[model samples]
Target: MDRKIFRLAIPNIISNITVPLIGLANIGIAGHLDSAKYIGAMSLGVTIFNMIYWNFSFLRMSTSGFTSQALGARNLTEATSVLLRSVIVSVSLGVLIILLQYPIGQFAFRFILSGEEIKGYVEAYFRICVWGAPAVLTMYAFNGWFLGMQNAKTPMFIAIFNNILNIGLNFTFVFGLGMDIEGIALGTLLSQIITLAVTVTVWSLKYGRLKKYLRYADLWNKVALRSFFKVNADVFVRTFLLTIVTGFFTFASSSMGDTLLAVNALLMEFFMLFSYFMDGFAYAGEALTGKFVGAGDRKNLKAMIRRLFFWGFLVNLVAVIAYSFFPGELISLLTDKAEVIRVAKSYTFWTVLIPITGFAAFLWDGVFIGATLSKEMRNTMIFASMMFFACYFIAVPLLGNNGLWLSFILYLGMRAFVQTVIARKRLKLI
Candidate 1:
């Protein structure tokens, strides 16, 4: 079990690490620009895209769970069908997002307050990056499918290539050509398309045999489709609430002022950094749990869960230590702006606490995802989100930014607490 956990986790951890590095690259580039407005605009723009992509994360989560189960059962046809269904849903949703881009942009701006100075840059970033919707969502399905098949290395390679390409392109476009936010957007858009192409190519070479099972009639299998939507609907609601909380975080910071918003954005990179690292272990739990469930291997399932929790704790312990000790050195990587860095230092404690507060939630998310227990996941998310808003309302009035950080911390802790209680009651070791 230990070997299996590390086998799946280590590659995923490396791959996931790159995701935060990409964010760091974007922030670093924007930070070097003449003003912090570029960073703020990029954050707003990315949030809008996150709203769209993360909301549809069901494509990845559901597909991984379903496919892993099929593989565990040695049902290649069913695994292929799962991927096909996810692709169909993702492509359709992506197209819808493109069509509704204007309305989506309008809705996003309602939550963002960069004033006129930064608003134009935000809009430009959104318009240009929105074109990657199909590629972005489709890659979600592909990435999920790959993980489900226990092929983390492929996704890792693809992710590394994608991020490196994006950073290189951004540097060239922004600095070499002297462009602005649009240059960053263009780099991201182009990289996504290229990554999607690579994903398809890799699938063709490695798992092309599975295509034999891609019958269109099977694509609409009533039983399978019902299960798919039932799980995905719960995830959809959960992700939507998550988006709301995150978007509100940015909105709240923006309400304070542009410099504060920029400070918060840089700080968010810490959260993102922690999440991506933890998600590697979480992904392992998902893959292993689903396989065990599919095979009805109760003994191994119980063992894997224990191992996952153990490693999860160790990983977060390391993260907390790093965040606590090297706060200044870490945040400095994102920007040289002394003021933004100063404000960020004040909030560094929140980042230090996040890994410890949130690691369980991240781990259990994978557990439930692997078990296809979407209702449990969604219910816990709803409860945590409610607690978040309540804490924010109560604390922000008294503590100001400190209150906001408190609310966010409480939200993470609540997720871990609520989900653990629920999982303990529902999950049967036998």
Candidate 2:
């Protein structure tokens, strides 16, 4: 059991780890180059993409659930069909995104950056980077399919390849080639293209013998597609809510003005790192629970959950201890700005707080996804989101930024509690 979990999780951890590197890479590259506005520009620019892309994150999340369920049932054609359907849906969404890019770009820039200099750099990055939409979304589908198949190594390789490409190309275009944001933009675009291509090639080699399933017929079959849409739609709502919740933090931080905006932006990297690390185990839970439930092996499922929960808590405790023990050293990795560091230090509690507060929520989320319990997940998020805003509205005027961070801690903790209560009700565990 340990071997199975570790086999699946290590690559996921590595793959999951690089995701943060993608944003931080942009921030780091921009930060090291010159001015604060550049960092602001990069952060806001990426946030805009994040808000947009993250809404569609259900494409990956739902695909994993459905595809893994199909694989677990040993329904090869259905599993293959799931992959086909996702690629078509994801690609169509991407093309639609490009067609309407201008207004979207404008709205994002006007709202997020607003300041003239930062806005200009952000718009420049947006224009050039918009071209990667198709490739990146396609890669989202590919990633989902790979994880669903219990093959974390493929994504690990692709993610590593994707980042190395992004970093190297960013260096060439931004510094070595003098492209600045354009370099970063172009590097990002090409990396997606590479990731998508390699993913498709791998899919063919590993499972392509089931080629009959990979047809336009599979892509648009209304009945199966509707099921796909329903599952993904539920997941989309779940992720959309997540986006909105995070958007609040962004909106609140941005409202506090640029220094706070920028500090929260950098501090987000710290908290994002903790989430990224925890997601490693969450991904493992998703895979293991999917396998067990699909096989209807309830006993193994229960045992696996027990072990995974322990693993999740132990790792989080270590993270909290590390954050508590060594403060400044971790900050230096993110920025040269002492102000950003100082402000981040003040709110370091979020880091120490998130692992304990949020870890169970993530583990339970994996279990829910593995069970494909979208409605229940929706209810939990809805309840938690309400608690967050209520807590935020009540706390912010009194606590300021610390209150803002506290709302987050409350949000994660409540989300876990609500989910736990619901899970018991659903399974009659009580």
Candidate 3:
């Protein structure tokens, strides 16, 4: 069990680490530009993408859960059906996003509230990057299916290669060719297209023979299609509500001041960093739990969840230690701005608290997803999101930024608590 968990978790951890580094690289490139507006524009543009992409993350989660379960059941046709269904949905949704880009761009900028100059850069970035929607969404389906098939190394390799290409291209365009923000957007578009092609080519080489089992009719299997949307819809709601908390966090921080916003952004990277490690085990939990459910191995499912949380807690502890012990060193790496560093240092303690409070939520999310217990997951997220807002309203008024951090921690705790209650109640059903 330990060996199986590590086999999936380690590669995921390594790959997930590169995700944030890609964001940091974007920040690095933006920082070199002449004006702060460039950075602000780039951040806004990326945040919009984050909001959009995170919502559609259900594509990957659902695909992973369903595919893993199908594989465990030894249903090759079902697995093929799962892959096709997800790709079709992703491609359709991608096209919809393109059609709605005009309004989407307007609505996003209105809420973000940037200066005209920054907005111009943001608009330019959005228009170009929007074209990558199909590729990005397609990649999500591919990655999820790969993980479902217990092939973590492939996605890990692809992610590292994709990010490296993105960063290299961004540098060449912005610094070498003098393309600026447009360069950044174009680079992302091109790299995503390449990554998608690679994913499909690899899938052909490895799982192409499975094509014999694929029925065009399976794409619309009434029962299977219903289950797909039903599960994915619940996940979509859950994810959207989750994004709201983070989005609101950013919005609220900006209201406080740019300095506070910067401080919180830097601190939030710590949260992102912690999640990369925790999510590795969470992904393992998803694949393993789904396999157990499909195989009707309740004992192993329960055992998998236990071991997942155990290792999750230990890994989060390592993050807590790093944050607590190396606060100065980590803060310095994020920025040279003395004020941002000082403010970030003051809030560094939150990093230690977050991982411990949040690990269970991360791990259980995978467990629930794997089991296709989306209703429970959805309910818990809704309740937790409400708790977050309630706590934020009450605490932020009295405690300020610390209040915000407290509310965020409580939000994570609430998710774990609620999910635990649900898991206990539903243990017999699966």
Candidate 4:
């Protein structure tokens, strides 16, 4: 029963691809509309949700790390228990988010977004998407569990199917039904609900035998629960910082005016697109690293890192080539606004460089997360974030929009450098 890395990576790659495919699909759906306002609105709205939900990404990351460790120890019982606890926490948080959507949207807009028009779109998008929080969060937990067990295919299936459904629904509602932003919201909402159901069904069929080991009693153990909290707390800080940085990117873009905001948003889409692809390899690293660490196999961990870094470099190289050739083609497809396209073209240099500066950081995130070195992950982010702000304040006043882009590139560079430094601290690399 030797593990085939590509076998695992293929599914993850498929699943990861769907995420940005959906984003592109959403932008495409909105692109058909007459106004750039729709484009800006959807971008702002989604960024807000991204900030909130991304902060809780630990639900997936922590669950994968913990469950993979248990599974590696040949403890199916503990694996099931770990998953159950993660779902409970994820769903509880989801409920709280849905309930506070209105106030949250208001606060986020006033504090984070720069204008009333952007706020209006952001609020409208949130109002509709809030209802789907439970489904989305639950998906995160299931995605992690499946990946942890070396079952990337299941999550990939769900991710691809969900994207297909989302795209179809978006077309129907936005164009056929004239639904607009409400359509975008409903598309994601319905798609997530379906995906969650499919995930559970797959879980039952695949990991069903382990259900017998379901021990609700274990959730009460202070020692086990304490470890869970410790890991999650560290991951939470890391995720929160991630969310805050994302928020700052959007907020800063918004402050630069509507045109630059749209430009920055489109630029972000390019970076996020590249990131989703890179995440597939990181995910492979995360799952494999967690398993190897849990089994106390440092040799295999090194092997996994070598293979992942190889693949990461190749993949990012392709992205750099793609973005370099036709940045306009991608931007035009996302929005119909000619002005937005022009601005985005002007900033293409930063987008092209993003894959280079940030690729290592994204891949290393998988490595660190799989190892459940969340405290280290948190520390890396803290340093990177501090660098982000220090660079931003000095650059923003002088360079304006270009400064923001360069700062972000540096932010990613900082993340990689800091993570590598901390890895040496933990692994005694020196």
Candidate 5:
């Protein structure tokens, strides 16, 4: 069980780590440019894309869940159909995003940008990068499908390849050609397209034999299509609620003041780091849960769940200890601003509670996703999100920023608690 979990978890951790590196690399490159506006423009452009891409991440989550179950059942035809249907949906959505880029860009820029000087740079970047939507979204499908097939290494390799190619191209375009943010955007676009080609090639070389199971009729089977949409829609709603909670956290922090906002952002890095690790285990839970459920192996399913929680709590302990002991060191790594560090240190206790409150929710998310229990996941998120707001409203009046952290902590705990009850009642796995 440990080996199985690690097989999926380690590669996923590496993949998750690489994801943030690309953003950091882009920012680092922009920081060395002629003006600070370049950095702001690049950051805004990336934020817009992040918001767009994040909403569509259900493509990967849904594909992985359904595909894993099909594979567990030894239903090659259904597995192939799952892949085909996911790719079709991804591409269709990607193209739609491209077609609607004008309005999307206008709406996003108007809400996100405050400075006119940075707007043009962001617009140029958006125009170039928007064309990569199909490739990016399609890759989401492939990555999810691969994970469902119990092949995390492939996704990890794809991410690494994409990162290296993107960084190299960005350097060549920006420095060699003397271009601005457009060069960075172009690098991202070309890398996405190239990496997608590589993904297809990898799929062909490794899993081409599965093509024999592919049937065009299966792709459009009404029942299968309906189930797919149902699962994905549930995940989309859950994700949207999650976005609202996290986004509101940031917004609320900013309302307190810039220093408090910086403090919150800096402290949230601990949560982000813990999430990256926890999410890896969650990915493992998803894969194993789907497999065991599909095979109707209740014993193994329960065993996997136990081992997953063991590892989850183990990681949570480590995170709590580190956050408690090294708050200043971590804050220093992110910024040299003494005031921010001092303010952030005052909130370090919140970071210590983050892993304890959050690990179960992260792990359960993977398990529920793998089991295709999307409705339950959505319900729990809805309850938790509402509680988040209620806690914030009631407590913020008395506790200030600490109230915000308190609300977030309770929200995380509530999600885990509710999901645990659901797992016990529905899956009988408590």
Candidate 6:
């Protein structure tokens, strides 16, 4: 069991770690620029994409859960059906996002971001990056399907390749070619497209045989389609609420001031770093739990859950220790700006609580997702989001940024606590 968990977790951890490295590279590039506004602009741009892409993350989650279940049940046809269905939905939605990019960009700038100078840089970034929606979304589908098929190494390979290409491109465009924020955006867009092409080529070479099982009829079978949409819709709503919390966090930070925005943005990277680590294990949970559930092996399901939590606890411990002891050293890696780094130090303590409060939420999310417990997952997010706002409203007045951190911590803790309780009740039935 431990071996299986680590098999998936390690590659995922390597792949997932590269994810934040991309963000870090973007931030680090912007951080070294002359003004703090560059950092703020890049952060806002990233946040906007987060709001857009995070909602569609359902593509990956649902596909992984369904594919893993189908594979576990030895239903290759259903598994093949899952991939085709997800890719179609993802590509369609991606096109929709492109058609609607103007309005989305406008709404984001007008409502989500503040500060005039930063808006231009952000707009330039958004316009270029939005075009990658189709590629990004399509990749989401493939990555999910690959994980579900119990092929973490493929995604890891794709991710590593994408990261190296992206970082190199960003540097060449930004520093080598002397472009501004647009360079970073272009780098990302090109990387996404290339990665998508790589994903397709790899899938064709490795898993093309599965296409023999694909049936046009099964792709749209009313019952199967219903289940697919039902799970995805629930996940969509849950993910939407999640984006709200995170988006609002960025929005609120921007409202505080550019210095604070830069500080908070840099600080959040710590949370992101921690999350990628936890999510690696979570992915393992998702793959294993779905496999067990589909096989109706309740015993392994329970054992997997137990071991997942144990691993989650150890990851959290390492994160807390690292964040507590070396916050400054870590923050410095993102930016050399003295003021931003100085301001960020004041908030370093908050990150120490992140993994501690958030690890269970991450692990349970994977378990529930694998079991296809979308409703429960959605309900927990809804409740936690509500509490987050309530805490922010009540606490921010007294504590300011500290209040925001407090609310955020409570939000994480609440999600974990609620999900733990619900899992206890729900897993028994499964």
Per-residue accuracy of model 3 over 56-107 as CA lDDT, tens digit each: 9999999999999999999989998899999999999999999999998888
Question: Model 3: clashing residue pairs?
Answer: none
Off by over 4 Å in 5: 26-45, 113-127, 170-184, 251-266, 336-343, 395-401
Error of 2 at 357 (Å): 0.7
Which of 3 and 4 is ahead in TM-score?
Answer: 4
**C-alpha positional error of residue 397 in candidate 6 after TM-score superposition, expressed in Å:** 1.7
- Name the candidate, 2 or 6, with the larger TM-score value: 6
Per-residue lDDT of model 4, residues 327-425, tens digit only: 999888788888788778989999999999999998889988888888889988898888888899999899999998878899899998888777766
Please rank every candidate by lDDT, starting with the best. Answer: 6, 1, 3, 5, 4, 2
User: Which sections of candidate 1 miss by over 4 Å?
Assistant: none
lDDT of 1 by residue, 394-428 (tens): 99999988899899999999999999998887888
**Maximum-TM-score candidate:** 6
Residue pairs with colliding backbones in model 1 are: none
Per-residue CA lDDT of model 2 for 162-196, tens digit only, reads: 88888888988888887777789888888888778
Candidate 5 clashing pairs? none
**Per-candidate clash tally:** 0, 0, 0, 0, 0, 0
| TM-score of each prediction | 0.98, 0.94, 0.96, 0.96, 0.89, 0.99
Worst 10 residues of 2 by lDDT: 421-430
Question: How much lDDT does each candidate structure score?
Answer: 0.91, 0.80, 0.86, 0.83, 0.85, 0.94
lDDT of 3 at 383: 95
